[model samples]
Target: MGWAVARFDFSWGDAEYHQETLENLKAAIKSTKKLCAVMLDTVGPELQVVNKSEKAITLKADDKVILTPNQGQEATSEVLPINFAGLSKAVKQGDTIFIGQYLFTGSETTSVWLEVDEVKSEDVVCVIKNSATLAGSLFTLHASQIHIDLPTLSNEDKQAIMTWGVQNKIDFISLSYTRHAEDVREAREFLSKLGDLSQTQIFAKIENVEGLTHFDEILQEADGIILSRGNLGIDLPPEKVFLFQKSAVYKCNMAGKPAVVTRVVDSMTDNLRPTRAEATDVANAVLDGCDAILLGAETLRGLYPIETISTIGKICAEAEKVSNQDQYFKKTVKYVGEPMSHLESIASSAVRAAIKVKATVIICFTSSGRAARLIAKYRPTMPVLSVVIPRLKTNQLKWSFTGAFEARQSLIVRGLFPLLADPRHPAESTNATNESVLKVALDHGKASGVIKSHDRVVVCQKVGDASVVKIIELED
Candidate 1:
């Protein structure tokens, strides 16, 4: 007699809060399992100054502003209370200050741009380069040979990682404003201390010049990279943003890491549908071979969050249908490190085998999610279903996909679906055997209409001390 097979199940109630937006989100994920991810935004402990005045503060050809370290301080027409301490010590007379690419050069400068005429311990006076306004916007100080040392992870970020992340078993944690490889390492170390490194994967947000400069190094340490264009546009030249995003996504693929293009639909925040430009932007990212397209403000705070996700998913699926599969795989293949190369070879073989045999699906039983990601990196035509063990990893993978190794690192990669594999009969071993788990995966796929009787299935799993790949003919 054949052994009893386990199955994978997802409860809408336990998935997340019950709401129209969330329900729609779950349906979207179910439809686009391999290409979608849900990101929960969090505000870090870092504080910035905001204008207390409701009105915009316009600066003409010349305007003097005060930089005070007063919290909740009111702003006047001439004095702007900035809460950054040591600002006067860090900036000099010729230093340039930028508010969303608006330049304000120092007074000792030669150009007619905004010049800092005077620098006090707590205040700096500047002459505006042109008529500009500071209406509660984020600003950055740019100076030659100037370095700003900020915390890698803020206190609030730490608290959230330990509290919300641990409690919910989130699949991936995206570190915002990551400046260096050290930042990624620091975040991993923090997660390690919190006992989350094994289950929660980390994604580095490459948004600024500094992060982009050290992207390769950061990519080596991070599970994936999120190309955040909104923040990149703030500091980088507008014309170079798209080029950088495309280049970054290509590089990540070459490195065998998932790369996500983000903030493609900023205009959909208020509109019921995406603008023509926004729709085109998303389709272009998909054509660029991005593993995933991320929606930020448009899906989180936007009036039509469900519509935004639904629209983006449809666009991505359509783009994928028309994309050149052979070219996509060729672009992603390049020289990689030892273990990665080995795993990539395994995944590549599975894809080839499935295609040759006309398999319906590729089923992977993963403890750390590597087996699943390796398969996804190949961008196979058949849907890859990951039977992730450890109930925590299952729940976490729902958000993206994680354990002994970094969890759910391949959550957003193309053509990968993660499911929790639960055995009805609990065994003593911490890890389940490959044969038993494969049975579970097959059973779940059939019950979910992903597989039919006599369907060909490609199975990939890591057995004790060795990796196993097999082709199985299912029966009723």
Candidate 2:
């Protein structure tokens, strides 16, 4: 299903709560005989409105509001307590501050828009529009075309990653509200310092103008890219979010990184079915060649979680039917620099050989999961079985981290099925030969029912110091 990647959001709950939920989710996946990867989303830094009491405040259009910074009191209709020191610095007269989660497409009944009328030493006075109820909440603050001086990585975010992520060995860590390349760099560097527990991959979430401005540099540091259209709408004009998504996805493709689009099926959170617009949005994103579609509240707290997954999955499949992979492949390859690296050359050749032969599947053995990522960049129609051949950790216990972590990391890429090699299998002995390794991979395919007898499969592997692509028909 489109539920291959499961996200545990620190944005909503603490890591401890997420850990328990994760275990339960894993058990569910195990019971259903399904595969899913984990993505731990950092809460990052945010501005929120605090209230003196847990009660909703009624506000109408033309209502006067005062936004005070960090005074330790709850918000009222006349005064809103925002928990940020630099709020006044970024917001000024005539500036618009939108509240609520994903309020880009402001509904007359729900979205809250405020125009700053005056900036004072203690607070900023504003006027409200689009009549909506205000409440004691952790709402997102926005100042379009302006960069708020929020920390690149908040302490809470660091605590989550360094503690929960390291303990569980997360597959992907999506940096929230990433503003620049430095944000990604800092997170990765922190991860690396955690010794062998740093097997995680970082995905930069581009949601604002600052991130969009530094997209090139961020892409270089991030293992993948997440186009957060909801937040993008809040940062730019809602109508222009599509332009950002299209451009960002295309750029990620050319750069050979997986691009994941989020919030494509948000309406399913409360409704029994996705709206027609949401359905079309999913199809269009798939057609745009996104590697995956990420759901937020749809699966986190939505009532029709299963149905949403099923519906989006079907939409993605239908979109793929009419997609021009051949055209996309050419465009992707043409951007590669001359004298391609050894790994790139092998990856491109393998993809072309698979397509030309019309192979049923493409199987490759990878140590770092790089081979699978490169093949995914080519967007092959057939599934690519990326068998993760793990490395021996030098630690005292010698427990391998690459096998499972790398496998999970590869699953988010489109058309790639990452499977960890059965370390206990006799054929996977430390001193095994290439033939034995190939035998184990083929046996895995057979056991998983991915390959049938007499099926033609493309095999990409290394021989001594060189890589080769071979086409072979499985024997009965």
Which of the numbered candidates is closest to the native, going by highest TM-score? Answer: 2
Residue 194 of model 1, lDDT score: 70
Instruction: After the best TM-score superposition of candidate 2, give how far the Cα of residue 245 lies from its true spot, in angstroms.
Output: 0.7
Candidate 1 residue lDDT tens string, 1-476: 00011000111112244234445655765686523333433332222445656456666666565556664677655665664676667777876554321122211221123457778767777667666655534333343223345575776677656765665455677787777999889888887777544456678877678888898899999988888676576457779888898888878877768787777776677788777988899889888878777665565457887787788889887888898876666555534434545678788778778878989999887766777887887777778997766533244445332231232444566777766655442211435454576677777788879899898998887666666778999877
Score every model by TM-score. Answer: 0.75, 0.94
lDDT of each: 0.64, 0.81
RMSD of each: 8.4, 2.2
Model 2 clash pairs? 51-74, 51-75, 52-74
lDDT of 2: 0.81
